[model samples]
Structure formats: structure tokens, C-alpha cells
Target: MQLTEAHAETGMTLLEGPVFDEDGKLLVVDVTAPEGEPKVMRVDVRRKTSQTVHTDGRGAYTSAQFSPYDGRLYLTDFAHGEIVSLPPDGGDLRTFFSGEVGGAPMNPDDLAFDEDGNLYVSDSRGLTEGEDIGRVVRIDRAGKEATVLADGLAATNGISFDADHRGLWISELTRNRISHLLLGAEGKTASRHTAVQVDGGLARTDSIAVDADGNLYQGLHGRPAMAVYDKYGERLATVEVPARQAEGLESATNVAITPGGTRAYMTVSGPAGGYVYTFDALAEGIRQSNGG
Candidate 1:
């Protein structure tokens, strides 16, 4: 497939999360510099322009998702170890979950909400390698409590619900694999098994997004391609990104598809800056808002 440069060299320190809001605008997080403040950017795909929507002068933001239950935007604040929210129109950010919950530090990397409005967070522990301390926590809709669904993961990063809302897919970065957790009646994890093992140059998987047809799109950290997989852990295709376009980037951090799945967006991160690339997906993205 031919990939087009939707926006490039935008001076973003590091771009991670990418999600389409209800208005059809793509919302992404600018991680800024290492230990630098983070900002949320709204991208106009047609115009190929990006504008800052929310900026936190203190912490780094990683992922952003729009919740259909409350019609608000929820974000993962990595630096501050918190989950925050704000109106879709943009306003003062409010803390949804903070400090430590479920006997673990907050260090959330990415998050996804379940069908019942419960938020699931991947607590990465900020460790890059050889650490089995990562965890997956579930936060109630009221944002008052948390429950650890799974632990002892190697850098839990990406997370999303399957198209049927019966399985929760999570990416274990250091382990180089994705796991599918079966959900019980009350949104609790009943069991989990490795869904896919990423190998070769694209071993390190970061974030994941699903299409309406139950195909999974994974952002490869060490490669320039997005790995595609079927619902039953079968590799279907790999979308190769042009090297010249991702010039200085070291990894593709996140992938997001539009509501209609006609177009897809990806974020590549590097020291110089981050780049957001768009391509024709022509597939309907799974409705994450409805926990699909």
C-alpha cells in the first residue's frame, strides 16, 4: 500500500498515542522531550495541519482515547503516573485516577475502556528491559478504585478490546508478544493466553489498534512497518513505511485508524522529533468507543 505523509517535522518531541475523536479529528499526544512536558495535538487530516489542544506544563502524556460513555477524552499521563480527562472541546484537565492503585505505582503507558465504562491501564513501571514488573489494572467508571487484572508482564504498553468485546489484547514490549485476555461477566479477566509472538526485526511491539473486521494493527518499535494480524493470532500482512519519510525515527510508537477506517495514522518517535503519517486503510476501524 502507498503511504502518504499526512504531517511531518512538526517539531513534536515524541508522538505516541493517536485516536480519532467523535468529530473525526485525530488526537495525538506529543511527549515532547525526555522528561519534558507533554501536549495533546488535534490534527486536521484534510489540511495536514496540527494544533495543540491541551498542554500539561508538568508531566508527559502518552495515549488519548475518547469515551463514548461520558463523551470525554481520557489520557495516560506517564510522567505523573495518572489518568486524566477533559471535555472534547478542551478545558482544564481533571484527574481520573492518580497515585498508586491496586498495590502498584501509576506509571500508565496506554489505556482502553471496557463495555461497562471501566478503564483498563497498562502500568509499565518505566522499565525498558528484563523486568517482569509490568501490570494491567482496571479502574471503575467512577474512577474511585482499581483492580489488578494481570501482573508480571514485561513492559505492558499497548491495549485494546477485541471487535467482539470478549477479549482484551495487550502488548508486552519486552516479551515481544501480544496476549489476549478473556473477559468475564463483570469485566474481570477470566484467563489469558499469548495471541501473537512478534519476531525478526519487528519483535518489539508498542501500541495496537483493531479494524472492524477483527484485524489487528500493531506498531513495531524496531521496524518501520505495521504488523497486521487476524483475530485468531494469524499474520495477514505487513505495511511497510518508507525509510525516507521516517528518516530519523527509531520506532513506530502507535497506530490509529479513522472511524470509517478509510484512513490510518501512525506516530514514529525519535530524538530529533516525532512524525505522524497517514495512509489509505480502506477498512472500517473497530468502534473502540463501544468497547469493540
Candidate 2:
């Protein structure tokens, strides 16, 4: 189904995160809404209709993922530098994570959760050449404390754990690269290195998801496509929006493949409007693709 809409009346809407609830409803966030406009929406995948689930004059909710432990939906608030949560129906509005962490301010862009309920957030501070302002932080299972997992990044965007849950993959927007981090004892980063480099002449990668076979569905911002890369960093394939459907759509920001589901649901937005596109995933979708 083709879904499109403009935020307010400005002929613009920026759709960021795409996630699926336990009941199979697709949920997304509109980052370009006007004050008091709805930011979170529940998209009827089968009928291609959308309904507002949350709204606020403040907060740019970038990404949302259902936690494996608590089953609550967790989100990263880029505008407020915080992490928030709500029930599947979008009520409660609990501030899950906020304020400064690791002695540094947070500009959370996205989030991923481990099976143990530990949360990982992308602390996006934009590009600072020669200085890594962005970071990845781990909020413990209790949501009581945080630890800096990886620092020295530029505009860190999407995040996902490997199929085995032994490693993590992060997209560095400013650098147009993907790096893999090996989790050591107690979840500290054991080692890391750039695994894949994108030819983002003008656009970098955004949110990402992993398949059961360990392939990465790398979403793009400023481009109408998603690239697939193998676990070893080999380019598998790229799915691009057809030109007929690309005029008003600027990017395919984030892709979510529900665990035990069939299709890859991509959230897109541009100067003219926002949209959702789909593609058949090469491998079975796993837990990592649901949001992380």
C-alpha cells in the first residue's frame, strides 16, 4: 500500500523511525510536525492508513523499538536529548532516560536494546571534525544508570546488534561509514573498526536492521534507497524507490523488519511529503530488525 502525507500545510514531512508493535501494527514518527501536531503514528500496513498515537509541541522522536524484556516501547528523543517510553497503545508517557550522562550532554538519535533489557542510545551531537562529539551509551536493565560504550563518533545514527548478539553495528553519518563493535566482558566495547564504507557523495546512512543471516539493511538519508551488506561487510544488494514514486520522497530513513515477519517496511520523507515503501527481505527477519 502507498501511504503519503504532508506535515501541517508546508508541503513537508520527515518520517524517521519505523517499528512494529506486537499486534503487528506499524508505528512511525514524524520529525517535521508543527507544534502540538502528532509525532507518533500507527500505520495500518494492510489498509495503508495512519492514526496518531502521540503528540507534543516538544520532542523530536527519532526512533522507537520494543524492548524484549519489559515489552514497553522505548524511544530516542533527539530534540530533548532524552529517551522516553510508552505502552504499545502510546499512553503513559514515561521519561525513561534523560539529563546528562557520562558527564556529557546527550542528543539521542536512536536506540537498541539487548536481550537483558540494557538500552543503547546514539548520542548524536552532529559532525565535529577531529572531535567525536557523538557517542553510544548503555542504560542498564533497570534504567537507573548509564555507561558510555563507544565515543569519538560523528553524528551517530542507526544502531543494531548482530544476529548472535555478541557484537554491535553503528552507522556514522558524518563519516559515511559502518563500524562493528565487539562486546567484551560485561558489555564493554572490546574492539572496533570500520566494516563498511558507503559512497555517500551527498547522503549518509541512517537507521539500520539485521536479518537472521547477519545481513544489514542500511537505510539512507538524502537518497531513496536501502543497501544490504553481509555480515562480513560485503555488499549484497540495494533496493531503490522507483522513479515514479521518488519525486516528493527525499529519503528512506529507517527500515524495520518484524521478527517472524515477511516484508521490510521502510519509513521515508522529503520536501513534498512522507511515505512508506516495502521490499522482500533476503533472509528471515530477526529480533535485531524490529527497531535496533
Candidate 3:
């Protein structure tokens, strides 16, 4: 098959972050309101069924990931800038990390983990019209206080470490760019640089993923397409989604690439009501990497 829509009736109102569990199931967060109560949903691809992972009736869980250390799901309560750890099978929920140290806005958005199990969260305080603030925070596994590793950016929305965990790629939504922060040892300090800035009408970049070949796949919310870039910061290809009348091909929010880099998934959330999209390697070879 050439990329067909699956699980259209899952009731995913505003599906953003979709991550795979070790057991081959996909989980996504569904929020009906912008900052309203949200639920974590687990979808079994093989069985074609959906189950509620957890629902708190509090702030919406916009983004999440599975912690390799304890196998628990860590969810981000965007409005409160809190991270909560939930049981793998959906039971007890406890606060993982919350608070603003030194008077910084820790509006956590998306998260990723390093080899040592340290968590990296992208905080988007500049998203609002008057906020004019943003930062990327790192919280080690010891439950200690959080600290801003990078500061004064234009809305840091998504973040992930390179395969070697030596480099970080963060998406700045307002600036339409992805920044590369180089790090060394103890996860202590780093130098920052812009990897790529995609500034077209199509650049509503959100969650991103890096492929096995060190290619970055960025999702564009304004346009139903995904931009692929090489390690040296070159625009390689743009994967187009099948057009739809109401929702378009991709409301193209949070993106996740397969471990092999051969497949990718994006949440299409317009009038389609949030359906997961899969694209294969065939759609990826259409462009050559720009000379870097």
C-alpha cells in the first residue's frame, strides 16, 4: 500500500506527540481544548483498538515520552509546565518535575531523553503574543531542581538529541528554525548555533525526529508537508501528504521517524480530527541534499 490513513475514529481531538512503546504500540495525547483537560491514548495498530491511558481533568497533556529507566510514561502538562510520571499500564500518576527556578518561564512543550536517562524539555514561553520568553530545560534523573541550558530564544517547541547524544536539535517555532547545540560531558554546558531555518509560508515547524542516517525530519503545521535535512544543514527533501478538503494532508504536528529511518509518522489534526500518517522511503528520495 502507498500510505493510507489508519484508525480514523480514535477521537484524537488535537493529536500532537505520538511515540512508540517497546511493545510496538503507539500512544498519543488528545486534547479537545487549547489548554483544557487532556487524555493519553494508547492505540494498538495490529488489533485496531484504542484505550485511554490516563485522564486527569486538569491541564491538557500536550506532549509525552516513555522513560527507558522505569518504563513509565512521562507526560507534559503544558499549561502548568509540569512533568508527571504515569505507570506503564496507566495507574498511579505523580509529579516528576515542576517549578521555575531563578524566575524563569519553564513552559515545557516536548521532551527527549539522553543515554544517561537525563530528560530534556523544550520550554515555549514566547508562544503567546506578550510573553517574549523561552528556554530549554534539563532535569537529571535524581529529581533535582531544573536548570535552563539555553535561553532567550523565540519559542523553543521541540527537542531531540542526536544518535550519539552529543548534539541537540531544537525547533524554534516562531523563528522557523532548528538550532544545534553542541554538548560535551556531564551534560554540563554547550555552545549554540543554528542548524537550519526553514522560512517559507510552509514553515510552521513543530516536533522533529532524526533518522538513522542523521537526517532531520521536521513537521510543518501550516502546510501539510515534512521537510528533510541532512546533518550539515541542507534541505534534502520535502514529503508531501495526500490532500484533503477539510483537514488537508497533514495538520502535520509532532513527527516520529522509525528506528530504521525508512518510515515516518505525523499526526494530521485539522477537520480529519487527528489521524496518524505513515510515509515510506519512496516519498523520501525526491530531492538531493543542498550543498552545505
Largest lDDT belongs to which candidate? 2
- Against the reference, the lDDT scores of all candidates come to 0.75, 0.83, 0.68
**What's every prediction's RMSD, in angstroms?**
3.9, 1.8, 5.6
Error of 2 at 79 (Å): 1.1
Between candidates 1 and 3, name the one with more favorable lDDT.
1
lDDT of 3 by residue, 1-292 (tens): 1112223343335677777766756777764533223377777755667777777657567687777677778888888878888886787899998888448546788888776667888888879863547788888876595777888888888787765568788888888889988886767556899889886485577877766566777777776677878878888888766654334444566665444335556666655456666776422310110000
Runs in model 1 deviating more than 4 A are 1-12, 33-38, 126-129, 200-203, 289-292
TM-score of each model, in listed order: 0.89, 0.95, 0.86
Residue 19, candidate 3: C-alpha displacement in angstroms: 1.0
Q: How accurate is candidate 2 locally (lDDT)?
A: 0.83
Error of 1 at 127 (Å): 1.8
Two-way TM-score contest, 2 vs 3, winner: 2
Query: What's the distance in Å from true for residue 248, model 2?
Result: 2.1
Taking all chains together, the TM-score of candidate 2 against the true structure is 0.95
Give the total clashing residue pairs for model 3.
Answer: 0
What shift in Å separates residue 196 of candidate 1 from its native position after superposition? 0.8
